[model samples]
Target: MVDHRQRRDELIDVVWRLIVEDGLAGITIRRVAERSGWSSGAVRHYLPTREAILDAAAQRVAELIEERIKAVDASAPPLDALVAVLAAVLPTDEQIQRASLVWLAFVGQAASDAGLADAQGILYRDLNQLLVELLTMLAAMGFQVDGGPASAAVELQAMLDGLTVHVLLGRVDADAAQEVLRAAVNRLLTRPPEADG
Candidate 1:
Protein backbone atom coordinates (compact mmCIF):
# COMPACT_ATOMS: atom_id res chain seq x y z
CA MET A 1 0.00 0.00 0.00
CA VAL A 2 1.16 3.54 -0.75
CA ASP A 3 2.05 5.64 2.27
CA HIS A 4 -0.12 8.71 2.55
CA ARG A 5 2.41 10.19 4.96
CA GLN A 6 5.11 9.99 2.31
CA ARG A 7 2.91 11.76 -0.19
CA ARG A 8 2.21 14.50 2.32
CA ASP A 9 5.90 14.81 2.99
CA GLU A 10 6.59 15.16 -0.71
CA LEU A 11 4.04 17.93 -0.95
CA ILE A 12 5.57 19.66 2.02
CA ASP A 13 8.98 19.44 0.39
CA VAL A 14 7.65 21.25 -2.67
CA VAL A 15 6.18 24.02 -0.55
CA TRP A 16 9.38 24.23 1.44
CA ARG A 17 11.41 24.82 -1.72
CA LEU A 18 8.96 27.50 -2.82
CA ILE A 19 9.36 29.28 0.49
CA VAL A 20 13.11 29.06 0.18
CA GLU A 21 13.23 30.51 -3.31
CA ASP A 22 10.34 33.02 -3.13
CA GLY A 23 10.39 34.05 0.54
CA LEU A 24 6.82 32.98 1.45
CA ALA A 25 5.03 35.89 -0.28
CA GLY A 26 3.56 34.08 -3.26
CA ILE A 27 2.92 30.62 -1.90
CA THR A 28 -0.57 29.27 -2.45
CA ILE A 29 -2.13 25.84 -2.95
CA ARG A 30 -2.40 26.40 -6.64
CA ARG A 31 1.19 27.61 -6.92
CA VAL A 32 2.55 24.68 -4.96
CA ALA A 33 0.47 22.21 -6.92
CA GLU A 34 1.63 23.70 -10.20
CA ARG A 35 5.22 23.55 -9.02
CA SER A 36 4.78 19.90 -8.09
CA GLY A 37 2.90 18.96 -11.27
CA TRP A 38 -0.31 18.27 -9.38
CA SER A 39 -3.70 19.92 -9.14
CA SER A 40 -4.67 22.37 -6.40
CA GLY A 41 -7.04 19.74 -5.08
CA ALA A 42 -4.17 17.30 -4.74
CA VAL A 43 -2.05 19.82 -2.85
CA ARG A 44 -5.01 20.52 -0.57
CA HIS A 45 -5.15 16.84 0.22
CA TYR A 46 -1.79 17.30 1.92
CA LEU A 47 -2.19 20.84 3.25
CA PRO A 48 -5.79 22.03 3.38
CA THR A 49 -4.91 25.65 4.11
CA ARG A 50 -2.20 28.21 3.46
CA GLU A 51 -1.41 28.17 7.17
CA ALA A 52 -0.81 24.45 7.06
CA ILE A 53 1.61 24.88 4.17
CA LEU A 54 3.55 27.53 6.04
CA ASP A 55 3.67 25.41 9.18
CA ALA A 56 4.97 22.46 7.24
CA ALA A 57 7.70 24.60 5.66
CA ALA A 58 8.76 25.88 9.05
CA GLN A 59 8.75 22.37 10.44
CA ARG A 60 10.93 21.10 7.60
CA VAL A 61 13.50 23.78 8.43
CA ALA A 62 13.70 22.59 12.01
CA GLU A 63 13.94 18.99 10.89
CA LEU A 64 16.77 19.84 8.51
CA ILE A 65 18.73 21.52 11.30
CA GLU A 66 18.16 18.62 13.63
CA GLU A 67 19.31 16.16 11.02
CA ARG A 68 22.49 18.14 10.35
CA ILE A 69 23.35 18.35 14.05
CA LYS A 70 22.65 14.66 14.53
CA ALA A 71 25.07 13.85 11.73
CA VAL A 72 28.06 15.43 13.50
CA ASP A 73 30.49 12.99 15.05
CA ALA A 74 30.38 13.17 18.84
CA SER A 75 33.95 12.00 19.39
CA ALA A 76 35.48 15.19 18.04
CA PRO A 77 36.85 17.84 20.37
CA PRO A 78 34.17 19.99 21.97
CA LEU A 79 35.23 23.23 20.28
CA ASP A 80 35.60 21.58 16.91
CA ALA A 81 32.21 19.96 17.26
CA LEU A 82 30.69 23.27 18.20
CA VAL A 83 32.24 24.89 15.15
CA ALA A 84 30.74 22.16 12.99
CA VAL A 85 27.32 22.87 14.43
CA LEU A 86 27.66 26.58 13.77
CA ALA A 87 29.09 26.08 10.32
CA ALA A 88 26.25 23.75 9.40
CA VAL A 89 23.86 26.67 9.73
CA LEU A 90 25.96 29.14 7.74
CA PRO A 91 25.09 29.88 4.11
CA THR A 92 28.35 28.35 2.88
CA ASP A 93 27.06 26.00 0.20
CA GLU A 94 24.08 25.68 -2.09
CA GLN A 95 22.13 23.50 0.35
CA ILE A 96 22.88 25.67 3.35
CA GLN A 97 22.29 28.84 1.32
CA ARG A 98 18.83 27.64 0.44
CA ALA A 99 18.11 26.71 4.02
CA SER A 100 19.27 30.11 5.22
CA LEU A 101 17.08 31.93 2.71
CA VAL A 102 14.08 29.88 3.73
CA TRP A 103 14.93 30.59 7.36
CA LEU A 104 14.77 34.35 6.76
CA ALA A 105 11.27 34.01 5.34
CA PHE A 106 10.25 31.86 8.29
CA VAL A 107 11.41 34.55 10.70
CA GLY A 108 9.53 37.27 8.83
CA GLN A 109 6.31 35.27 8.77
CA ALA A 110 6.65 34.34 12.43
CA ALA A 111 6.12 37.95 13.47
CA SER A 112 2.33 37.65 13.18
CA ASP A 113 1.81 33.90 13.41
CA ALA A 114 1.59 32.65 16.95
CA GLY A 115 2.24 29.06 15.97
CA LEU A 116 5.20 29.86 13.71
CA ALA A 117 6.55 32.32 16.24
CA ASP A 118 6.35 29.71 18.95
CA ALA A 119 8.17 27.22 16.80
CA GLN A 120 10.86 29.77 16.03
CA GLY A 121 11.16 30.53 19.74
CA ILE A 122 11.58 26.86 20.55
CA LEU A 123 14.29 26.47 17.92
CA TYR A 124 16.07 29.56 19.18
CA ARG A 125 15.87 28.37 22.77
CA ASP A 126 17.24 24.97 21.91
CA LEU A 127 20.20 26.39 19.98
CA ASN A 128 20.87 28.96 22.70
CA GLN A 129 20.84 26.21 25.29
CA LEU A 130 23.29 24.18 23.27
CA LEU A 131 25.64 27.13 22.95
CA VAL A 132 25.39 27.71 26.69
CA GLU A 133 26.24 24.10 27.30
CA LEU A 134 29.23 24.35 24.97
CA LEU A 135 30.47 27.51 26.63
CA THR A 136 30.14 25.87 30.02
CA MET A 137 32.16 22.94 28.80
CA LEU A 138 34.88 25.30 27.61
CA ALA A 139 34.99 26.98 31.00
CA ALA A 140 35.28 23.58 32.62
CA MET A 141 38.26 22.95 30.38
CA GLY A 142 39.97 25.98 31.97
CA PHE A 143 39.00 28.55 29.37
CA GLN A 144 38.29 32.01 30.75
CA VAL A 145 34.69 32.95 30.11
CA ASP A 146 35.09 36.74 30.35
CA GLY A 147 31.44 37.43 30.91
CA GLY A 148 29.61 34.17 31.59
CA PRO A 149 28.25 31.19 29.74
CA ALA A 150 24.70 32.57 29.45
CA SER A 151 25.77 35.98 28.18
CA ALA A 152 28.38 34.50 25.91
CA ALA A 153 25.79 32.27 24.25
CA VAL A 154 23.56 35.27 23.60
CA GLU A 155 26.38 37.30 22.12
CA LEU A 156 27.71 34.50 20.01
CA GLN A 157 24.26 33.77 18.60
CA ALA A 158 23.79 37.40 17.64
CA MET A 159 27.16 37.45 15.96
CA LEU A 160 26.38 34.28 14.07
CA ASP A 161 23.14 35.76 12.77
CA GLY A 162 24.85 38.91 11.55
CA LEU A 163 27.64 36.92 9.97
CA THR A 164 25.14 34.72 8.14
CA VAL A 165 23.51 37.80 6.66
CA HIS A 166 26.83 39.13 5.46
CA VAL A 167 27.52 35.75 3.95
CA LEU A 168 24.28 35.84 1.97
CA LEU A 169 25.05 39.33 0.75
CA GLY A 170 28.40 38.24 -0.73
CA ARG A 171 30.34 40.30 1.80
CA VAL A 172 31.63 37.15 3.48
CA ASP A 173 32.44 33.67 2.30
CA ALA A 174 31.91 30.39 4.12
CA ASP A 175 35.50 30.12 5.22
CA ALA A 176 35.47 33.69 6.45
CA ALA A 177 32.26 33.13 8.35
CA GLN A 178 33.70 30.01 9.95
CA GLU A 179 36.78 31.96 10.97
CA VAL A 180 34.65 34.72 12.44
CA LEU A 181 32.56 32.19 14.34
CA ARG A 182 35.62 30.55 15.82
CA ALA A 183 37.21 33.87 16.68
CA ALA A 184 34.06 35.10 18.38
CA VAL A 185 34.00 32.02 20.57
CA ASN A 186 37.68 32.42 21.29
CA ARG A 187 37.24 36.06 22.21
CA LEU A 188 34.32 35.21 24.47
CA LEU A 189 36.53 32.66 26.15
CA THR A 190 39.28 35.24 26.58
CA ARG A 191 38.41 38.95 26.37
CA PRO A 192 35.56 41.22 27.45
CA PRO A 193 32.82 41.97 24.95
CA GLU A 194 32.74 45.25 23.03
CA ALA A 195 30.13 47.89 23.79
CA ASP A 196 26.79 47.12 22.15
CA GLY A 197 26.09 49.02 18.94
Candidate 2:
Protein backbone atom coordinates (compact mmCIF):
# COMPACT_ATOMS: atom_id res chain seq x y z
CA MET A 1 0.00 0.00 0.00
CA VAL A 2 1.20 3.53 -0.83
CA ASP A 3 2.11 5.61 2.21
CA HIS A 4 -0.45 8.40 2.04
CA ARG A 5 1.54 10.64 4.41
CA GLN A 6 4.70 10.29 2.37
CA ARG A 7 2.86 10.88 -0.85
CA ARG A 8 1.09 13.90 0.58
CA ASP A 9 4.37 15.40 1.68
CA GLU A 10 5.85 14.83 -1.76
CA LEU A 11 2.92 16.57 -3.36
CA ILE A 12 3.33 19.49 -1.00
CA ASP A 13 7.01 19.73 -1.88
CA VAL A 14 6.14 19.79 -5.56
CA VAL A 15 3.75 22.60 -4.87
CA TRP A 16 6.54 24.46 -3.15
CA ARG A 17 8.75 24.21 -6.24
CA LEU A 18 5.84 25.15 -8.45
CA ILE A 19 5.28 28.22 -6.32
CA VAL A 20 8.91 29.15 -6.81
CA GLU A 21 8.66 28.49 -10.50
CA ASP A 22 5.10 29.60 -11.21
CA GLY A 23 3.52 31.00 -8.04
CA LEU A 24 0.22 29.89 -6.45
CA ALA A 25 -1.81 30.07 -9.64
CA GLY A 26 0.29 27.35 -11.21
CA ILE A 27 -0.41 24.74 -8.56
CA THR A 28 -3.04 22.37 -9.87
CA ILE A 29 -3.41 18.78 -8.70
CA ARG A 30 -2.35 17.57 -12.11
CA ARG A 31 0.60 19.94 -12.16
CA VAL A 32 1.71 18.76 -8.75
CA ALA A 33 1.38 15.16 -9.86
CA GLU A 34 3.44 15.92 -12.99
CA ARG A 35 6.17 17.61 -11.03
CA SER A 36 6.18 15.16 -8.15
CA GLY A 37 6.57 12.06 -10.31
CA TRP A 38 3.23 10.65 -9.34
CA SER A 39 0.05 9.98 -11.26
CA SER A 40 -2.88 12.39 -10.95
CA GLY A 41 -4.93 9.60 -9.47
CA ALA A 42 -2.32 9.03 -6.79
CA VAL A 43 -2.03 12.72 -6.09
CA ARG A 44 -5.79 12.97 -5.76
CA HIS A 45 -5.76 10.10 -3.31
CA TYR A 46 -3.57 12.35 -1.15
CA LEU A 47 -5.13 15.69 -2.09
CA PRO A 48 -8.73 15.52 -3.21
CA THR A 49 -8.93 19.18 -4.21
CA ARG A 50 -6.69 22.05 -5.35
CA GLU A 51 -7.46 23.89 -2.13
CA ALA A 52 -6.43 20.83 -0.15
CA ILE A 53 -3.07 20.83 -1.93
CA LEU A 54 -2.55 24.52 -1.24
CA ASP A 55 -3.43 24.15 2.43
CA ALA A 56 -1.05 21.23 2.67
CA ALA A 57 1.71 23.24 1.01
CA ALA A 58 1.18 26.20 3.32
CA GLN A 59 1.07 23.94 6.38
CA ARG A 60 4.28 22.28 5.27
CA VAL A 61 6.04 25.63 4.98
CA ALA A 62 4.84 26.64 8.45
CA GLU A 63 6.02 23.36 9.93
CA LEU A 64 9.48 23.78 8.41
CA ILE A 65 9.95 27.24 9.98
CA GLU A 66 8.53 26.14 13.34
CA GLU A 67 11.02 23.29 13.38
CA ARG A 68 13.89 25.67 12.57
CA ILE A 69 12.86 28.05 15.38
CA LYS A 70 12.58 25.16 17.82
CA ALA A 71 16.07 24.04 16.93
CA VAL A 72 17.85 27.33 17.75
CA ASP A 73 20.63 27.09 20.36
CA ALA A 74 19.33 28.05 23.80
CA SER A 75 22.70 29.23 25.09
CA ALA A 76 23.20 32.17 22.73
CA PRO A 77 22.96 35.80 23.92
CA PRO A 78 19.45 37.28 23.91
CA LEU A 79 19.84 39.51 20.87
CA ASP A 80 21.78 36.87 19.04
CA ALA A 81 19.10 34.28 19.73
CA LEU A 82 16.33 36.64 18.69
CA VAL A 83 18.14 37.50 15.47
CA ALA A 84 18.60 33.83 14.70
CA VAL A 85 14.91 33.17 15.25
CA LEU A 86 13.77 36.14 13.19
CA ALA A 87 16.18 35.27 10.40
CA ALA A 88 14.30 32.03 9.95
CA VAL A 89 11.43 34.06 8.55
CA LEU A 90 13.61 36.30 6.40
CA PRO A 91 14.83 35.42 2.93
CA THR A 92 18.49 35.41 3.93
CA ASP A 93 19.57 32.29 2.03
CA GLU A 94 18.48 29.85 -0.65
CA GLN A 95 16.49 27.63 1.73
CA ILE A 96 14.93 30.56 3.55
CA GLN A 97 14.24 32.20 0.19
CA ARG A 98 12.10 29.27 -0.89
CA ALA A 99 10.18 29.28 2.37
CA SER A 100 9.72 33.02 2.08
CA LEU A 101 8.33 32.61 -1.40
CA VAL A 102 5.71 30.18 -0.15
CA TRP A 103 4.89 32.34 2.88
CA LEU A 104 4.70 35.59 0.94
CA ALA A 105 2.58 33.88 -1.69
CA PHE A 106 0.24 32.77 1.04
CA VAL A 107 0.27 36.30 2.38
CA GLY A 108 -0.75 37.60 -1.04
CA GLN A 109 -3.58 35.09 -1.08
CA ALA A 110 -4.70 36.30 2.35
CA ALA A 111 -5.98 39.58 0.89
CA SER A 112 -8.79 37.73 -0.85
CA ASP A 113 -9.00 34.53 1.15
CA ALA A 114 -10.62 34.88 4.56
CA GLY A 115 -9.17 31.59 5.79
CA LEU A 116 -5.63 32.62 4.86
CA ALA A 117 -6.14 36.07 6.32
CA ASP A 118 -7.23 34.53 9.61
CA ALA A 119 -4.14 32.31 9.58
CA GLN A 120 -1.99 35.41 8.98
CA GLY A 121 -3.64 37.13 11.94
CA ILE A 122 -2.85 34.18 14.15
CA LEU A 123 0.74 34.14 12.87
CA TYR A 124 1.12 37.86 13.55
CA ARG A 125 -0.22 37.40 17.08
CA ASP A 126 2.32 34.68 17.76
CA LEU A 127 5.09 36.85 16.27
CA ASN A 128 4.01 39.72 18.53
CA GLN A 129 4.18 37.47 21.57
CA LEU A 130 7.66 36.34 20.56
CA LEU A 131 8.80 39.92 20.14
CA VAL A 132 7.43 40.79 23.58
CA GLU A 133 9.36 37.89 25.08
CA LEU A 134 12.53 38.96 23.29
CA LEU A 135 12.06 42.55 24.40
CA THR A 136 11.72 41.39 27.99
CA MET A 137 15.00 39.58 27.53
CA LEU A 138 16.56 42.80 26.28
CA ALA A 139 15.25 44.55 29.39
CA ALA A 140 16.86 41.94 31.56
CA MET A 141 20.05 42.38 29.58
CA GLY A 142 19.81 46.11 30.30
CA PHE A 143 18.79 47.56 26.96
CA GLN A 144 16.81 50.82 27.19
CA VAL A 145 13.92 50.58 24.78
CA ASP A 146 11.73 53.45 23.58
CA GLY A 147 7.95 53.38 24.16
CA GLY A 148 8.35 50.18 26.18
CA PRO A 149 8.50 46.58 25.03
CA ALA A 150 5.01 46.26 23.53
CA SER A 151 5.44 49.25 21.29
CA ALA A 152 8.94 48.19 20.38
CA ALA A 153 7.61 44.78 19.38
CA VAL A 154 5.05 46.32 17.04
CA GLU A 155 7.62 48.60 15.52
CA LEU A 156 10.08 45.77 15.01
CA GLN A 157 7.41 43.67 13.30
CA ALA A 158 6.64 46.45 10.86
CA MET A 159 10.29 47.02 10.14
CA LEU A 160 10.93 43.35 9.46
CA ASP A 161 7.90 43.06 7.18
CA GLY A 162 9.02 45.99 5.09
CA LEU A 163 12.56 44.70 4.89
CA THR A 164 11.37 41.27 3.85
CA VAL A 165 9.29 42.77 1.06
CA HIS A 166 12.23 44.77 -0.21
CA VAL A 167 14.47 41.72 -0.07
CA LEU A 168 11.88 39.65 -1.93
CA LEU A 169 11.70 42.17 -4.72
CA GLY A 170 15.52 42.13 -5.23
CA ARG A 171 15.77 45.75 -4.13
CA VAL A 172 17.92 44.43 -1.26
CA ASP A 173 20.00 41.31 -1.03
CA ALA A 174 19.84 38.97 1.96
CA ASP A 175 22.98 40.35 3.59
CA ALA A 176 21.81 43.94 3.17
CA ALA A 177 18.44 43.05 4.62
CA GLN A 178 20.04 41.37 7.63
CA GLU A 179 22.40 44.28 8.22
CA VAL A 180 19.56 46.78 7.93
CA LEU A 181 17.43 44.89 10.42
CA ARG A 182 20.35 44.50 12.81
CA ALA A 183 21.04 48.20 12.59
CA ALA A 184 17.39 48.99 13.16
CA VAL A 185 17.30 46.74 16.21
CA ASN A 186 20.30 48.55 17.63
CA ARG A 187 18.75 51.95 16.97
CA LEU A 188 15.53 51.02 18.74
CA LEU A 189 17.43 49.89 21.84
CA THR A 190 20.22 51.20 24.06
CA ARG A 191 22.05 51.10 27.42
CA PRO A 192 22.54 47.44 28.21
CA PRO A 193 22.16 46.34 31.83
CA GLU A 194 25.06 47.06 34.17
CA ALA A 195 27.10 44.12 35.45
CA ASP A 196 26.86 45.22 39.10
CA GLY A 197 23.14 45.86 38.98
lDDT per residue as tens, model 1, 64-124: 7777877887777666777788877787778667777777777788899787687567567
Q: Which 10-residue span in candidate 1 carries the lowest summed lDDT? A: 188-197
Where model 2 places Cα greater than 4 Å from the true spot, the runs are 1-4, 119-123, 140-142, 195-197
Please state every model's RMSD to the true fold in angstroms.
Answer: 5.1, 2.9
Q: Which pairs, if any, clash in model 2?
A: 142-192, 142-193
lDDT of 2: 0.77
> Model 2 — which ten-residue stretch has the worst lDDT?
188-197
RMSD of candidate 1 to true structure, Å: 5.1
